[model samples]
Target: MPALCWNQRRRDFYAITTDVSTEGIRFRSSSRLSPGEDLTCSIRHIGLLEARIDRAVGEEFTVSVRGGRSALTDLARQFVALSRAQDLRPEVVRVHHRIVPKQKIVQVTLDGGLGVSGHVLNISASGVALLVEQSLEIGATIQVGRKLARVMRHFTHGVGAAFLEPFEPSAVHEAMTL
Candidate 1:
């Protein structure tokens, strides 16, 4: 499954889980990480977890999960359930999972510098769903907080905009402004 990890510097990188167990998780990441490094990872179907790198061999690394055994067992169970669900109905899974933002109200700026206030319904690495009064045309370029995006679709309450460039999965969290 897709995974996101944040290094000690708070920079985020994308990763894919190759193996998981109550003891640790092994993943392949494009970003080079050193052994003994610390990371905070968010895995699909599993929430945030703290880990320490045990070994790094090129793109593959193993990290010992840092938490109680019971918690790890629970997370392993959830992973099993998610794997079964995916095998049963892969089409039902979303390409990019949406997460609710802690700070929903955001300032949106149009091409001409027109500013509008909007509320974030949900956000993902690729795009955001928002509730705004302004009727924006499809393909309209706009800035949501610090990121530039283009309107992709319209809904009853608002519009869906895809980011010009995808954000690091860990960057779209509660502490972020948008």
Candidate 2:
């Protein structure tokens, strides 16, 4: 499963889990971490956890979870359930599923109160991909519809942005205007 791990310095890195259990988790990361280093790990759908690195060999590392056993057990179960559910569904490349909105035209507000009209290519609870004529710089803060978002990536014809505050998963729908 995909996971995000943050070092004590607050730098985040993407990781993939090789093994998981109530006691500890083993994963591979590109971030160089020493044994005994502390980390904050967030597993999708499983929430965040505090952990201490127990061992590190190349890119693989094992971390002992620091928390109540019951909480760890619950998180482990959730991970397993979600992993299984993912296997049953079609392969999903993105973190969140996107839907086309009925209203494709939207107003994108720039930082200085400048608003430009754009087309919504697709939207998810976390972010939106929009086709705009104006060139937007990556990392610029912009308002998509009514939601505040930050540009994360730029495509040939559009820009991808992550919402500053994510919407509820249930709130995303085909008929919704945002």
Candidate 3:
């Protein structure tokens, strides 16, 4: 499985998992990892997994699972699900609005004026997918630029938010450009 690795204080980097077991996982990363370093590992569709470096040999490293055996079990399950999903044809679903790809850096303000930075993955008249470092609880309301939105789903990169009201294309374009 493809994985992401990043130190607590640094940005995430792409990695590939060589093996995984109930105890831990072995992966290769371009980023140098020191033993005992704290890092977060994220695999597509598996969500985030907390781990600590246990050993490093060249670019290959072994990380001890911090989420315990249950985390590994969940990871295994996700791997199986992903493999099964590959055999199915992609499904087409209609939505209230057309989604367009738009990558833009924007500031999000949560309740209490707490602010976080996120990258807009895509935007539609009624919703958006944002890539952020912070994890927000589902159903939390946040202000994306001047628009109010509610968190709908959590992804490996960040959260999906549905806006309180539909946005005009010009308004979305104008806001995202900032």
Alpha-carbon runs more than 4 Å astray in model 1: 1-93
Instruction: Name the best candidate (by TM-score).
Output: 2
Clashing pairs in 1: none
- The per-residue C-alpha lDDT of model 3 at residue 154 equals 93
Q: TM-score order of candidates, best first? A: 2, 1, 3
| Candidate 3 deviant stretches above 4 angstroms | 88-178
| lDDT (0 to 1) per candidate | 0.88, 0.88, 0.81
Model 2 TM-score relative to the real fold? 0.49
lDDT of candidate 1 over 1-178, digit per residue (tens): 8889997686899999998776578999898889899999998768889989988999999888887677668778888898887777445345677888889999999999999999999999989999999989999999998889999889997999999998988776766676
lDDT (Cα, tens digit) per residue for candidate 2, span 43-138: 877778898888999999988888767766877888778878777856636877799999999999999999999999999999999999989999
Candidates sorted by lDDT, descending order?
Answer: 2, 1, 3
Better candidate by lDDT, 2 or 3: 2
TM-score winner between 1 and 2, please give it.
Answer: 2
